[model samples]
Target: MTSTSSTFIAGLEVGHFTDPRRPTGCTVVLARQGAVAGVDVRGAAPGTRETDLLAPTNLVERVHGIVLAGGSAWGLEAATGAVRWLEEQGVGMPVGPARLPIVPAAVLFDLLVGDSAIRPDAEAGYRACQAASPATPAEGNVGAGAGAVVGKIFGIARAMKGGIGCASVTVDGVTVAALVACNALGDVIDHDTALPIAGARTLDGLRLLDSRRALLAGEAPRPLIAGTNTTIGVICTDAVVTKIQATRLAQMGHDGLARSINPVHTMSDGDTLFALGTGAAGKAPGMMTLGAMAAEATARAVVRAVRAAHGIDVAGLKLPSLAELGRA
Candidate 1:
């Protein structure tokens, strides 16, 4: 049987730990039974851990969990917590005498969104694991998306709130799903309508500014430092796949980003995607079919991210939601 909820993949659980003090936190996706995994990094500047092990030639074939976090590189500590929690649960790759949790993680730069000092840490990551569930994950201004913002082409003052979103598709009893934390450097568009949904605003802060067209028109943008933006996500499927195929799935997942996010994969962004194959359904769809489903799920998740976000007004930072802009 297939789940009606898009986020419910067969063999994965999702969790988030958002810092109450500031807009910084972490999210964890657990494959406790172990799943074949691969990763693809499209942006120029990415902060990640244990990604090399996901290479097709690497020794490890499966990962126990994947972490997506905020607080720049410091958020990588969250993965440490997830590792510890998994170890306590006796879930990990069997070492000579001990069980070592295999967790690969990625982080986005959210330091500028709130108090940089209040970033996700080992404890935050542990809490996120404790909150893991199979139900649909909470979206918008939560998890890694709490501190996320978009459309920085004009600067922070003209940016909109970015967030996390999830979607899934099932074909022939094989399920594929995606969960994304959207913190892009450009505008988010409604793929169906081809209109800007959230992103850079006019200097007057009254209307949406089409970032792609504006950039093409040679409008000078504010100086955007590297590592200031990113969009991180995970693609999961019940279909069996090899590490190489999983990597290709991650690569195709980027198509979803390109479809919904303008000016994606910029030098300042560290866009990364990870793919997990659980083999829960004991079904192996053709690679082409799986990739197409992945792309579609990813694109829908990206659009849902901005639409689900709420306006942010705290600590002297104010990023409006699509609703606030009358576009929701």
Candidate 2:
């Protein structure tokens, strides 16, 4: 299989189009030839498109692409641009002379972190698709992770900047890769050391605040006014699998989220995960082994998102990156 940095799956092309002006953007995962796919949405306030089509009982056996973007529900429009691009390439389910691309999408609430009036649109999505390639995807403060922030349990004032992250692992002959946009309502932690790496910060911006501890102490701040939060991502592999297995892979992917983020899948979060199989690898691993590997990759991706992030000042409000905070 053709290998891209952090992506070992063949027939998969990853790309992103970022707008630092709005400080938001979109990421596109294109499988022009189509690939088996599945989805799992665990958050109570998710914004997603065409997720039902990925059900094992659905008639569609494969999907053309997946879109992850910022702008909350408004970001969903980005999928249309991806669809249009795929259609132009003659990739999709044939209906007549034209083929309709099956593009599923999900979005995170980054409106509050950037120019709220400016959100990702169809044009942004099309551009992302046009940039698709089997190359190492750019991480941190790009694409859907551009305006992402985490640790909102104490409100946006205490939240830290979040971004995109990716990781991959090879088990037997199968390769599993995960890409994530970290925008959540809680803090991000390092699973290996069980230490808080990023999230809410003290008012002085000198130390990390334990969100869960604060909430338990009845000092939780009111929710932010602008929008809810979410963490959305995709997991791709070269193992052949049925839709049922793919769905299981997505569920396991959530285990990774749980490992890295505190207070995840909250009511204010729209966490969603999608899994795709290219069927390029010679054989598939057992369900248990595949799911376990997916979880590990997902966890690593979440940490990388914050670690790769750089601080930015938006609208006179300075949001610090994990690296900067570590220095302080």
Candidate 3:
């Protein structure tokens, strides 16, 4: 079940689009008024849009837009469409119509998942804007996750489908939530228990937890090797935070990935996280409090992406969901 946007409901509006043919799409998020934001970078091969602005410590933004798209680096054009729509509505930094609406974005390496030629564009971004709602948002293989894959050690031939996911919890009177698109090179594990949640399943239908082991055992990472690229989208939230704090939050959020994904942020991977605040808090909220909540939520989101996915097959291995395992 999806929840609406409210302080009681994480206070964030969400939207998304999916394409099986392009096998890649996007997820967009918008916050209530007066929300400060930032970002963190931790991927070996990242293709992003509008990250520098999100990292400045002297900036005081209210509520900007967040976009998660497919098309590798080319898909970045999609953001321009979003900015155009936002500028028309006067949503952005305090720079008037000319420079209003500071839209930040991230992209994944889905070039091989779909038509490398059919990249996401301003039209796609416009469509994404039309599709975005300030309420419930779809999850799973829908949106940017449409072309996502996991355990790409063996490359595209061995990876399984991935998608968008979300989770939230209140800590220290502040709601710190997370949403992620997991297309990683390693397995995503349980944050608290350090157990494999979404990684790889063997031919026998058991979890395959180690890629390095598979490689060390003389197993090729993939049937064929591909170029360096694969990205994850992360959004960590709480009460309003400065751009720098938001960036710090994004940095801290990486701790969650470190705990869960083995061989994470590899040279072939482009992992990034964005942090935002809804500006709805009344009392003081420590960064640690928000950081911890963000970490746990991020880990769970990764698991949800896999468990909610379908068509998870590559070569002779199958990555089924908890539903199939009778544990959902």
Candidate 4:
């Protein structure tokens, strides 16, 4: 599939603050007026914050920001910085004299890919907030995708680089977009062609090894693998939708992940998705249509993440990019 070239949604600003030193970073999606939001965590090992508040029964109807970061659980602190930034800007749920900024966040494990000691913190979140903008944000190796790696079925020794990607589509004047940081323990596949784009490489580094095929062949790796992978993302739409509908949208977003990644949502991966509805354009599409768009956009974004990624050497391990494989 071709890379997403012109995908955008109104009423949202995206930004990133990366620390290449640790090879970890944070990404913030801000809505100054707040947006109705919902989340769906499908992976068995998710690391998140404030997800309970996004439940349909929760009293909070809107959220000010969403944070995606590296550094495993420690990266949740980035959400605090995002909340502080929003509060300083006078945004959030108004109660008495204070506005409690609601920022839901998710983290991916990149510790083994880079400097495990340093992770994204409140300061990183704050910097991402300051860098927020409406223009298309840079993809691959920026923000939460900085240290992302994929296809660890055989272990880190055979893994390839992964990163952030985005895609959007306008249906009947309503825009739906998806931003994804691909850090899965699976191979990325081109949904349309059913071909592997990025994943574990053979020992010769001349061919892609399909993780699913290997697993199905009864090739089981060590048993100590835990919390070593995840893929996180956000789906944004200009359609007016309720919290339940938003939740449904987030659930549908996983269809994209399923289509593009082999062996997804594994026990060791924390795959989480968030949906945000701005309702700023005054025209809302049908729920089915919106959900389909969300899935397609998400799939495209996942492919883009692999396509835009650049190879990197972390510690003594070397990870290759799809481009380096002459597949881009």
Candidate 5:
């Protein structure tokens, strides 16, 4: 038997489509049997699709898939491909003669790192769905994390490489898992050690420059640009939850971000989290317990994202990873 992460909820599959042309791509999470979904957008600038319908008051209580992508707003197109793929698989909300798939999506900015013209499109999304698997997805410098960067408070030149990561926590039979694409304006901290693992670098690009402490010391940061940075992700749980409960779970998921990502949810970053309740375990842990696990999983995933990243030099831009800096 193969061992899986405690955060890996049964019956859910993850897939990625990375563009070889550059570090820009998309990730898709499929719940073919459908699952209750909710979302919370904490960042001021967000790029998303079908988010309004996830509100507790909306008619749609479940979503078949969720898409996280890079390439800024244009990456949302990946969700369309996911919808088409689901339709072909005969998985969706039954409505009359049609089986319309509901797939909400969010994207991060990575146009400056490489070829902005070669972003993920509908075909890329379809290919991601084709590669869906139950195994834990690969982390760092793939999918939406391909072009992701962090510690942009000092601008891209001194920023560190960011990537995708997944983590899960379990209490009794209940499990909560998270997958994060780290592209923020600040540093990723180790929640347990209270130390910065990755983020902005010193002027010489040889050491860590804690963004929060720098801001507190009255240091000036780069000019803010909305939607140029973001941290987008998804949360999954095996415990039972209603749509409203899922929304609250997503809100709690931000607690993990606050713990792990310094200067998070700023005006320049569009941090969004989506939650899906598959209820595969038939366990319904108290909201407090479930939320706590969700936060823990999210923070762990955030740190893992940068730790798994690899240094990249492209388009005349060189961003180093934690490994390259000997910080991993």
Candidate 6:
């Protein structure tokens, strides 16, 4: 596939951490006009804000901004920063003589990645919002994805690095894109091996365990087998959709997770997907086409997160990548 450079978003900016699993705060501007949006939570362990708007039944209502941050529940505080910044910039709904930016936000667990005490705060959020201005948003371990990881089923000792990933597809002139920060109890498979792209391997790069057998015999460990975990992201499209429709689409988007992960949305995982309408609605991509794009893009995003990450080795425990594992 040919890599497309990028088109910038005016009201959104992202900041990330160098260390994998650290906090990366972000800010999204509602801009002058409110955008249509929806939310979907499919994880067994979820912590979020403005989730009520995801009801799908009322997505048509305009939303000023969406924030995804790292800090577990604490990360959600970044939205306050965004709210304050947007308000200062007059980006939200007008109330009496003042404008109120309705910024909705989400949080993913990264306490396991960085300094649990170090989380995205309202101040960081404001910086992101203040800096955002029609620029290309950063990706890959940036923003809320700084401390994300995948395939922690074996435990943090072997948890692979995680980060933010993005992919976009075009359908009938309309385009839909997905950006995900995958830190789940599940595994993202290589398109070919059917095994985890982030799996531990032998000296020959062979999988150390029989995940297929584990799945069949039910000895296979899951997040419940491991602990609560989650994967979250956003799906954006040019297609015009009601909030509820987009919410349902976000739910349907979980199908991608089902296809790509081993044990998804487990009690320990807080997998979520938000859907937003750019309103550019380049053309009508139709529901099915856009949905398929979202799923495929999600899978790609998962791979990107793991592949872009660097291995972590601390104390006596060392987590290697597929490359280092090949030489084991």
Query: In what order do the candidates fall by lDDT, top score first?
Result: 5, 1, 4, 2, 3, 6
Query: Per-residue lDDT for 103 in model 6?
Result: 73
Each model's C-alpha lDDT? 0.91, 0.89, 0.68, 0.90, 0.92, 0.65
TM-score of each: 0.97, 0.96, 0.85, 0.96, 0.97, 0.85
Per-residue error for 173 in candidate 5, Å, reads: 1.1
lDDT of 1 by residue, 198-297 (tens): 9999987878999988999999889988889999999999899999999999999999899999989999999999999999889898889999889888
Candidate 5 per-residue C-alpha lDDT over 1-328 given as tens digits, one digit per residue, 9 for 90 to 100: 1124633578889999999989999999999999999999999999999999999999999999999999899999999999999999999999999999999999999998988898888998999999989788889999999999999998899899999999888788788889999999899999998789899999889899999999999989998667799999999998999999999999999999999999999998899999999999998978999899889999999999999999999978989999887443
| TM-score, model 2 to reference | 0.96
Best by lDDT: 5
Instruction: Report RMSD (Å) for each prediction in the order shown.
Output: 1.7, 2.0, 3.8, 2.0, 2.1, 3.5
Q: State the lDDT of candidate 4 residue by residue for 1-328, as single tens digits.
A: 3323343567889999999586789999999899999999999999999999889998888999999999999999999999999999999898898998999999999998766989999999999999999888799999999999988878887888999999987776778899999999889999899788899877677678787787788888545368789999999988999999999999999999999998899899999999999998687677889889989999989999989999887778888898887342
Counting clashing residue pairs in each candidate, in order, gives 0, 0, 7, 0, 1, 18
Ten contiguous residues minimizing lDDT sum, candidate 1: 1-10
- Evaluate residue 261 in candidate 4 and report its C-alpha lDDT on the 0 to 100 scale: 92
Badly placed stretches (over 4 Å) of model 3 are: 1-11, 32-34, 58-63, 96-99, 200-209, 216-220, 223-229, 312-328
Model 4: residue 54 alpha-carbon error in angstroms: 1.0
lDDT of 3 by residue, 249-294 (tens): 8888888778767668887788888888766675447777777777
**CA deviation > 4 Å runs, candidate 1:** 1-7, 326-328
- Runs of candidate 4 exceeding 4 Å displacement: 1-7, 222-224, 326-328
